[model samples]
Target: MNYPFEKVADGAEETKLIAEEFAEELNGGDLVLFHGNLGSGKTFFVRSVCSALGIDGVTSPTFSLVNEYHGEKKVFHIDLYRIEKADEFENIGLYDYLSDEDAVKFVEWAELFPEQLKDYDFLITIEYIDDNKRKIKIERK
Candidate 1:
């Protein structure tokens, strides 16, 4: 519930609780960048936040590049995992989604293009500690 919050989630349920608390501080037009490796629960964290915001059936946007959801507020979920070039990023019209003023945007693997993602409200890093535990850090700018 605080800026620069850090926690170690022992399992999915604990992660969900943390995400719920984090969601409480969110607002429409906020940009949240997620930094983590593969299978590090980046998408799961976003899903949990979406759920707390009254959205359901949240899934990774790996293939589609982005997913939109309507809840208490509009939500834009984006994944940069499959994108390997700046041109590809531009071709997908991601800039438009990033600039949406009526939606809360969550971008996974944002570290992939730090230069392009200069402005963000929150930066969350999820670290895989083991099969059941993850270290989550959230920083507000």
Candidate 2:
């Protein structure tokens, strides 16, 4: 399915619904790269996606680098918030996660290492607006 950039300025529930839609349409081996400022609901969107995929308790892997949730499907949530350089992801075994059997990868702060995103399937960008609203864009490049 071709999902153009979608807007979700309604509420948090609306944001989650958008994530659910992406989850339903997403296939195995898909890589989702998230771009936005801090507190822009990147992790929130990821959490909802994981939840929709039958996983639970999706959290940011800030200190741990990566967190894995296992259920009907697996979710690999990677956070590059503390990385000083782009090469740090390689040292953290990014390629291994990518090769893991059909697990979905949700990455935050991806724009910091644009070169690393070449293999990604989709780019999800979320921008916050007034009154608990968010402008979300999901596109394939």
| Candidate 1 structure quality by residue, lDDT tens digits, 6-96 | 9999999999999999999998999999999999999999999999999999999999999999999999999999999978877899999
The worst-scoring run of ten residues by lDDT in candidate 1 lies at 82-91
Cα misplacement distance, residue 104 of candidate 2 (Å): 0.8
| Each model's Cα RMSD | 0.7, 1.5
Return the lDDT, model 2, position 1: 42
Model 2 lDDT per residue over 31-77, tens place? 88999988899989998988888888777787898998876677789
Badly placed stretches (over 4 Å) of model 2 are none
Error of 2 at 121 (Å): 0.7
